[model samples]
Structures are given as structure tokens and as C-alpha cells.
Target: MDSRSSDVSARQERGETGGWISTPVTTDLLRGALDLEHTEHGALPHRLPARARAQCSDGQLAMAEAQPSGVRLVLRTRATAVELDTLPTKVAYRGAPPGPDGVYDLLVDGHLVARTSVTGGNLRTVDMTTGSVETRTGPVGTARFSGLSAEPKELEIWLPHNEITQLVELRADAPVEAVPDRGRQVWLHHGSSISHGSDAASPTTTWPALAAFRGGVELINLGLGGSALLDPFTARALRDTPAELISVKLGINLVNADLMRLRAFTPAVHGFLDTVREGHPSTPLLVVSPIHCPIHEDTPGPSVPDFGDFEAGKLTFRAGGDPAERAAGKLTLNVIREELSRIVKQRAAEDPNLHHLDGRELYGEADTAELPLPDRLHPDAATHRRIGERFAERIFGTGGPFAARDD
Candidate 1:
């Protein structure tokens, strides 16, 4: 057996601490999860439940959501040292350089204290030229952290936000238990890559996580990178999940993917909202348009990647659709904003909790000049913080849509 496999076996057999419990990483200890699927390696947390996943066979959607962007494991224990055995799935582009190593973040009593990476895991390779995919299996590895205070603490181990992970086991020097729910309001958010944290420094820095931290809410992030196409299954997933407040950031993905025209877009928005309302008739729901993306603001899209610095390992994107396409009913950021506002206003008469917030209000022309998107597509770490802070202030502060109801 390999050395890593031998070590795991030894720990399982020894029961090392005389009392250190070896906890099976079950769904009960997982937060920000909508579903848990058992795999040969271990338990895989899925952001979308089984019913939703079964309704569609889109491999892109399956992979994007299963990456566990905002998921974390919550445990209450007094252990000073913690070790987690995981089989992470890392992606590799065929022609481009290797992707960055995935990061695991540990938070003690809700404060980030350490960041680490495992040496080995699974690998998935994608060949852009042939449009083919392959995955190679690898042994599980461990991430260890120590020097924490001995006092009982609420510890959270955030899984890699961008990697597909299957949690194998969790071991600590002291016994651990699932953290009890703290009665925080749940915020369910759906968006594209920006909300999924494309260029954020770490998992915890993702805009959704940051906003959840500042707004004092538990986050259920359904930010599917490049797959936020307002699919019926996604709407159904949101409908079934319980939430006090919810928001959907739309536009960029649709335009960039060149998925649909203006004619098909209108009814799709109404239909998506209709599905959610069936389950949550009165929950506050907000519709946010695309933030300021200079390329897609006026021009249409089918964005193409720019490899000008490929040899230097730098990649960016540029819009390919022409500005004249708007006359032919093509979708654009401005067109999306107007349609979303009109739809919300027309529906607000009956749905009292429905609201609309222009994406520009969150990040507009003024902010773009100062905090430009690094890839010409996704915002950088600094911009993410600014957006998250702005979201907290505008959505959860006094007079905000999510402010506590006095009644």
C-alpha cells in the first residue's frame, strides 16, 4: 500500500488519542449543502439536490455545482489539532499551464486562522481542441492544522471552493460533535462566475461568503460558474430549499454564452420566478441584473478567450459579438436590465416581497474605472470585497429589503 494509505489505516486502527473519536464525514456536519451523494471514495456534497440534478443532463452544470464553491464542514470540539482526509478532484487544461493548487481554509469560532493544501488527490483533464474529458484516480491525502486553543471551539473547515471534493474522514485529538444551528437567517443566492468567486484569493473571500459574513446570515450559494442559465431545474432547486431571503444575479452568463435571444428571455424570467413562488409564496426575493461589464454593456457576446500572454501563463477574454446585433434582437446588459425591471414592477402588485435592484447600482461605471475586472470577465479579489461590502450595506442594512420585519 502507498504511504498515505498506510497512514490513514494506522490512524483508523489506533484510535490515536485513547479517546479521539474518528468521525465519519456525514451530511449532518456539513453546512451550505443541499444534497449529499455517496461515492466510492467518500461522501460528495452537492449544491443541487438529486431531483434537480436528475432533471438535466448538462455535464457543465453537474461539474460546476458539484465543485462545492461555498460548502464547509462545521464541528464543535476542543481539539487543538485537526486532520481531514479528502480526495479532491483537480482540473487541468490540455494546452494551457497547470491550474493553481486548491486551498482548504480553517476557521476557529468563525475567524479564519489557517490555510493549507493536500499533496495528492484526483485529476481531471480537459482537451479544448477535441472537446474531450478524462479523469484519473488518486489516493486520498490529509490536511492538518494545529496550535488552536484548547477551549471548546466552533471550527469550520471550508472545502476548496473551486475543486470537486469527496470528504473521506475527519480526525482530531478530542471528540467532536456537529455544531448546533445558531438561528441565523439563511440567504440563498444564485449567479454566474463572479458570484462563484472566479478571481477571489480564497474560498472565504468569495463575494457570497463575504456578504454572508457581514450580513449575519447563513449562505446557500448556488453560484454555478458559466452555468447560471436560468434553467428550470435551478429554479426548482431554489423553490424547494428554505430561505428567509433570496437573490438572483442575471445577464452576463446568458450574453457570454450567447444562449438565447430577447424573445425567449422574457418568458424564461417569468417562468423561473413562477416556480420559486410556488414553494415560497411570501419570502423576500430580489432580482439583480448584471454588474458593469464594459464589453457586454452595449455589445452582444459570445466571448472568446485571449491568449496573448499564453506563454507567460496569463489569459483573458474579449467579446466577439458585434454591437449591430442588438438591432436583430440580441441580448445585451442594458436590454436585460430594462426587461428585469419591467417584469418586477409588473409582478410587484401581487407579489409584495418581490424587488428589483439594478446591477449597476452594485458596481457601476464609476467603480469600473477604479476596480477593473482582471480577466475582462471576472472581478479580482479587491473588487469582490467591494461588491460584497456594498451588497451587505444595500440589502441587509436599515431600509434594505432584508431588514428585520418589525411586525
Candidate 2:
């Protein structure tokens, strides 16, 4: 070998390396269809969830299906645990279901850190009985396991391991530096299907994720597909999560779910903000209404041609958004606009940090004229990009967010 190569080898031999190695440990990176099956009373009942859970929500299994096509195994005694294995600094186990109903108490070194609702919310679209690698939970969020002890904490899944259930999409993420050095003013966001990237091209391509990348900030995305009904637990989650900036995208999901009406929405929003402000007394909080969706923009309640299509006339709203739901109050875009503004304003008097962003501003009825959500409920990739750009410019501004990377 040349002297340069020899010298490089010598340095490597001398243990002077702090960068990626030419050869990555490919044994773990092998690609395959990973599916986590579910079990009833100790037997396979359905397929596993298809979407990924949140980052801090990563879980492992006592058993799992190997990378090779359909091969499965019981990892109890055979599997090796990484003793004090290095985990991502920014990540932590938020909620692990320890008992039945697929729920686990979350602990960071024996301290009950966070508790999550059981598989209770994922039943609509997720298959708890089948074996599939599904993203069943919300989007990314902010957190730090700054002082995690080297104790092995047990995590329980909703599935029965003794039977046919096995964990798939076994991911252990190591957080990457999207921004070099910054103040770390985190962003907390809660939204609906668009926010959840129901049909957005990729995970990273989601508007919230993209906006986070551009803003040079960490994000906690709680964008559920159809679950953004302003739940109390969700609001509590937001209230508990630490963030310098926060935003809640309301509308579309509410309109589609036909869950509530104007009256309840107003108070629920008030209570949601009230709880959030309890945690972040002066954090910059923004409440965003729905973006432009013509059918639902003018009307209330969302319906689709199918579970996924919206452009066709076959797609229409359910007879003026349920009467009981409406009796809760007619929650149209106009109502959401009026109420969201009023709610944020009420919160702002006590906390000057509160703010509001009309979703129509991001993508209004006019914008929808040119660009509409493909399936009536979810936006396409282009819509995501557009929203991200707008969000960056509006909320983040040219200052490149309140927190930015150091040169």
C-alpha cells in the first residue's frame, strides 16, 4: 500500500477515529418485509400495526420475526441484549404497555416517566391480530433521557408473545443532527390527518417534519389520522411535554370525524389551552384551523369517495355534519376560525405568548381551487411541501426560527 494508505491505517490502528467507518455493520441493516402479528388468548388473531409509533415510543419484544421472509423465532433465551447499549441521546421510552390491552407503564430508569392510552385508539385502521410492521402512534416530539441509568426496564406489548405474536419493524433510532448547534427551542404540534401524513409521500416529507427540519428545531408531532378530536389525554400530553413553541392544527379531522360541534369545541379548546399554559406559562402557542378543502371548506363534516379518495363527487360531507355533533355546535371552517381566534385571544390575555394561525392562510379555498387534498381528508406530497414552505416563512420567518444552528 502507498505511504498515505499506510499512514491512515496507522492512525486507525492507533485508535484515532470519530467518524463513520467505511464498512457499516450490515448484519442489522438487512432489508426485508417485517410484520408483527397479534394474538388473542395466546394465538394469532390479526396483523400488527402498519404505521410507526413516535420516536420516544420505540419498543422491543421478547420475540420477533427475523429479517428473512417468514422465519420467526422466540428470542427469550436465544436473543442477546445490548448491556448498557448506547441509545440515541434525544430518545427515550415514553409509554410501554406492561399489562393486557397492550399497555405498558413508561419508565426512565424506574421513574414513571410517561403513561399512554392503550391500543384503545389504534383499532380503527390498525390490525392488532395480524403480523405487520405498522406505524400505529403519533408523530415525533421533543424529549431527553438526559440521565438514564443502565437498568434494563421491561416493556410489554398488547400482543401475547407465547402465542404467534411477534414484534416487527424493530427500530432503534439514533437521533441525527439536523441542526449543528442551537438554543434547542423545541416545537410541540397537534393536528389532524394532514399533520399525520396519512398520504404524504414519506415520513420526513410530512409538513411538520419538514417545517421542523427547516426551522432547525426538535418536534413532537401528535398528528393522528382521524383522532384529532381534542381529547383530554392528548391535551394533557401537550401540557406535560416541554416546548418553547407550540401549535395545534384543528378542523379537517373534526369535520370528518363528526365528533363534536361548536359549543364543545370552544370549551374543549379552552381547556386544552388552559392545560397547555399551565405547563408553558409563556411559551409561544399557535392554534391553526383547517387548510383549504373545498367540500369541507364551505361545508362541515368530511366524507370521501372511499376511505382514501376525495376529488370525485362521490366524495361529499355527511348531511351537514351530524345534528347531535352539530348540536354540540356547527363546527364549520367559519366556526373553527371564529372560535379558535376567540379561544387563543382568551388565553393570550393571561399569557401574552399565545398566538393563532388560520389554516386558510396556509392553504385557503382559493389555494384549494388550484390544489386540493387528494383524498378529501389527506393532502398530497406537494401540499405538504407547500405547507412547510408557508409555515417556515410565516411562523419561523427569515430569522430562521427563534433557535438556529450556530455557524
Candidate 3:
């Protein structure tokens, strides 16, 4: 019997009625989750496992990993109604009011059918000036989707990309089972906020998600916003994860964060690649630099929020570091690009599978002229689509770096 038939047969054997079945959430039912941790409320999906998380204590890293950028729950059922109870962590800036409620995207049989948001969750307040933070308890909320076709079909509930989700419970009118794997290659990617869907319209519209959709592959995104420095723990996480294709978008984070000097950056990049190669020596790996950020292209950073329209909830960024510091080994987009090219070319002879793509190729000078970044930092929704489509065409297209090996 087929898997769907077996599901029915098992339900009958259990003397079950045509009522709701509360299936336990297991790792098998989760995608885009590198790890799952039990919290006071429920299961918390983490892109980085505990071992790797233990190595870093940065609050930004902690929050970003918990945001569930690409994580989703997948199942197969004939249920007409499904409800998911979750506690989402909502963010609030000290001076600026809270943004819109985070959204949950639902797909049935590979087609987006609905978008919904839960009512209540935890709240975290941040004082960007003082760096003071506070957390408060909140009620749990439910996301209900009814009137689904009662035919055995695959269902995907994408968690909120901008908030940390604590999954409390899941209930469906019919038995639900893990979605059967379709043998799609997994593409593991690591980058900064742009890859984290900060300015992107929705979770599925994130450039990485878009590229994965067009490339016909599953994605594991480690796109930590404001926290994509080449941390050893992050490199270790990338080393351990299994992926057919991998890409690391470097430079912008290092530049904007102003975290390292050129002297330290070269060795850091080399060390990161070395660790990843230890685990997957022959896997196709691509190194991508930052996309066009006019503010930090030639300028150095440690970019600061403009806060010009704080009353209106508008936060934009401006490069703060002096360009003259570049002469003293300070990092800039231009400098990093030159160094990344040299490093990749030097290593390619020994590691033929390694390739480098200047991030500008994805959203370069010309495109920036037409569609500029709203905050002078991250790309907006339209630019996200442009980058995603360009990435799909350049990397996954014929003879591209991510082209299927069989093809």
C-alpha cells in the first residue's frame, strides 16, 4: 500500500474516530531546522544546534538564530481543518513603536493558499542607544486554517521569519504524517541580513527561498541578521550540516559590523573555509561577496541608524566609519571583494569544486541605479526578487556553479 493508504490503515488499527489527532512534532516533520530545543512553552526551532550556539554568547546571534528564517513544518494529511498553537517573540524598539505582526505562510500541495499571523507572543524591547534589553511574557496564539481539501496532500506551514516561534501544539481533523522526501538536493547558505529576509516582503519571497524554489532544491538558511561575522561556531555549524551545495555570502557583515581588520579577516576567511572543507572536502561550495551597498561600497563602516524619522517608525542606516581608515587596514566592500577574489583563485587549484561569485553580479551597479536599497543597506522586496532570479539564472542555470552533477 502507498504511504497515504498506510496512514489510513494505521488509524483504523488504532480504533480511531474521524476526529482530531494530536501528532507529536518530531525532527522528521521539520525542514530548514538544524536543531530543535525544548522551551518552557514548547519546542523552539533553531538554525544552529546547541553545541554551536554554546560557543557564542552574542544576544543578536541568539535572537537571529531563533527567528526561524527558513524553518517550516511539513506533513501529509487529509484534514479539512488544521490549527497550530505558537508563542512568537515580537520585537519592539525603545523609541520606535513595534512593527507589523509577523506572518505565517501556509502552502497546500506546493501552492500558497493563505497567509496568517497569531495574536499574542512574547515581547522583547531594545534600547538601541543604551543597549539595554527587556523581555516580557505574553499569551499564546493560534493560527487556524480551515476548509482545506480533504484529499491526502502535502501541507507546509512556514513559521514567522521575523519572529522567534515557540510551537506549542498542532491539531488536525485527520491523521497527519511526515511528508515523504522527494530526493531534492539540499542547498545550505550562510549570509547577513539580506539573506535573512529583513526587507523582503515575506518568508517565501526571501532571495534564498526564491532561488531555492527556482533551483528545485531544499534550503537550509543560516542567514543571521547583523550577526554573520565569520564566527568559528557558525563555521562549525556549516561544517557539520549535510549539503549538496553550499554558499557563504561574506564581506558586508564583516565590513558593516566593523568587526575585524583586513589583517585578521584574511586568516579568518581561510580558517572558515578550512573547517568547512574538512567535513565536505569535495562538495560544490560557492563564495559570494556582498551585494551593492552604496554607503559601504567605498566607505568603511560600523553603520549607524539614521533615526531621522523615529516618530514615523522609519529607521535607515548611514556609514559611520571614515574611509581614511582603509589605509590603516580597515575593511570596506571594495577591499573585501579584491581579497575574496584572490583567496578563491589561490585555493581553486587545490579545491576545484570551490567557486567565487562577486555579489554585485547578483545586484550590481546597474541594478542599484534602477532599484536602490531603501535603507541604504539591505535590498527591498523588488530587489530581493531581482537578486533571487539572477542567482537562480547564474548559479543554478546550465553550466552554473550549482548545476546538477548528473546534468
Candidate 4:
């Protein structure tokens, strides 16, 4: 008999209804999110907790944290089919056509089995030039997956990394339960848009997600897009999060936003690390500098969006700050990298578990020629894969900082 029929038979034998079973979308079923807010319609995952979110008034940070970069629903069930009802808030440029819908990736027992996207939720239109946003509400939609084996198996529904998703409901033909701990070390990572899965093919393919899978570790990605500005609250969030390994990818956002000068940037970095160390005193913490972005390498930012191709639905970014400003202590990618290296080396002297990884090693000048960033900022999907593979080899391989210990 087919899996559906078997489910019906099993339900009949147990004197229960054969209709779909509803499961609550609670913290037990969620991975990667630091907090879950009970919304009017459903549960919305946030990378930062309520306290941290309350501390920040920036809308970019609000949206980024709610986008759910590496978040997923993890469960074990014998059901042949599953359904998730979500209210996704998609972003759109003012004049440019809306980009493709965010992707939902379904993994069965650690292998990607299906991918899908939801339609008809909410739309957030942004006037990039003016930095103003408008919102329109739409109906919630369901993402369905079917044709699975009847035997019990673990299932992971990776939410869209670029859309703010409020999980409405979960349904399955058979009973579902939270998957028990697999004893994998949890790796917590923080970074900007690239690590937030910008332009990534899907949620699971984000560099951090890919690296986590390859390294056989659970991931709690705090990649808050343009909001990775060394916020003290974000540091506290990372500090309190339980993890065996930690990594912070810094620089790009700070440069692009022109949020601080070298003087402020240096102390902010130290304070962020100090806060995290307070909680995770001895965790294997890796400090990674910014990756290669030619425009911001030597030139400073506030990087502005180039809408020259707006009519054609293309958007790119260019550095707007004067290179000469670097002499006045305006931060640049090169400066950030040097400072980060110095900081890590200085700290590692007293903290044995502290480590440093040059971001260019993952995607450097050489790789740029072959796989140029599509938007002159974020790496393309192929680049994400390459970076993910390189990170796995460098950080989790033999003699690497996060390598498994014999003990």
C-alpha cells in the first residue's frame, strides 16, 4: 500500500482520525533562531531576542534579523507529506521589478529533497534612493512537500533567508515530533548580507549553512545583513547563545554604512568581543575580516546604490566616500582587515581558544576575476558554494582551529 494508505490504516487501528495532524510551531521545532515572538498570526523567528531588538530602532536591523537566514523547522515523522503555512514579507525596489520569490528548501535526513516558494503574503516596497519603505498586506500561503518514505525520518524545512517569514502552521499526515539531539557541535556565526544568504540559491546553500553541513555541526546563523555593525546587543545575543564554536565576520557593513571611523571601529570591535567572551569565555571563537570587494578595498564607503539600470531592473553599488578620507581615519576594508588581524593576535596571546581567519582566503582578488559579484557587492550563488567549501577545509579540517579533538 502507498504511504498515505498506510497512514490511514495506522490511524484507523489507533482509533484516531486520518486527517492531517497539526503541530505547534514552537522553539522545540525551530533551529538557528535565538528567539521566537508570538505574533498575531503565528510565530516569527528573530536572530536577536526581544531585549536586544528593543535596544535598536533601525528598521534595517529589524527586517534583517527577522529574515531567518539559517533558520529551519526540524522534526521526525513517518508522514509521506508535509505542509507549512507561512506569511512571507518580500522586499521590492521602488522602480525595479520585484526580484524572484524567496526559496524554501526541504531536506530529508540531511539531503536536499525539494525546493519551493510561497506566493501571496506581504510586500515591502523600498525607495532605495530615499531609504523609505511602504508595506502592503497579503494572504498567507502554504508550502507543501510530498512523496516521502513511510518510515520514520528527520525532516528540515529551511525557511527563506531573504524574506521575513511568520510561520503560521505545520501539518503532516502522520504525527511529528522534535528530532532528538544528534550530538553535533553547534556553530554560531555572525556576519553581513553575504552570510545572510543574499543572492544565495537557497537557505541551506548560504555559505555558513553549507559550511555547517560540511563540518557536521548544527548552525545558528546571526548573519543580519546590513546590520552587522558590531552592536553591543548583538554581541550579548551571541554571548548568551549556546554554542561549541563561534565566528564573527566583520567590516563590509561598517564600511558600506560609513557607521564609524577607525577610532570608533577599533574600540567597538574590542567591546563586542569582550562582551561575548564574558559568556563564552573559552569557546573556539574565530574572528574573520571582510572578504574582497574591490570598490571598498581601498576606497571608503557609504556605498550608494547605482540605479542607472533601474529601468532594466538591475541594481549595483558603488563606493561614495573619498579615498583621501582614509588618511583622516575613515575605515576601509584593508584597514579593517589589518586591525582585525592585530586585535586577534593581541587577544590570542592571552586567550588560547581565540583564532583568526583572513576573509580573502575564502574569496580573494584571484577568485573575483572568474566569479565576479553580480551586484558589485554580494557574491553570487556559485561564489557562495566556493566560499562554503573553502571555509569547511580551512576551519574544520585537520589542524584547523575548529578541528575535532581526540578527547
lDDT of 3 by residue, 241-329 (tens): 99999999998888878999999999999999999998899999999998888999889989988889876887788999999999999
Question: Which scores higher on TM-score, 1 or 3?
Answer: 1
Query: C-alpha displacement of 159 in model 2, angstroms?
Result: 21
Give per-residue CA lDDT, model 4, range 181-267, as digits (tens): 889999999999999999999999999999999999999999988999999999999999999999999999999999999989988
State residue 138's C-alpha deviation in candidate 1, in Å.
2.3
Candidate 1's C-alpha runs over 4 A off are 3-6, 9-19
Worst 10 residues of 2 by lDDT: 82-91
lDDT assessment of candidate 4: 0.93
Best candidate (score: lDDT): 4
Give Cα distance to truth, residue 352, candidate 3, Å.
Answer: 0.9
lDDT of 1 at 42: 80
Q: After superposition, how far is residue 205 of candidate 3 from its true place, in Å?
A: 0.8
At residue 388, candidate 1 shows an lDDT of 91
Model 1 clash tally?
A: 0
* Residue 156 in model 2: lDDT: 14
**Per the 3 Å backbone cut-off, how many clashing residue pairs does candidate 3 have?**
0
> Over 4 Å off in model 3, which ranges?
1-18
How would you encode candidate 2's per-residue C-alpha lDDT over 1-407 as one tens digit per residue? 73334434754795643332221212122111223333221112211123322212322211111111111111111111111111010111112222222212223321344332212222112222242334333211111122323333322111111122222222112211111223656777777657755445544556876787678665556665556677665676677766778888987767775677676777788887788778877777788888877666546664533322232222322324443444446666766787788877776777776777888778877776677665455667788898987897888875433434355
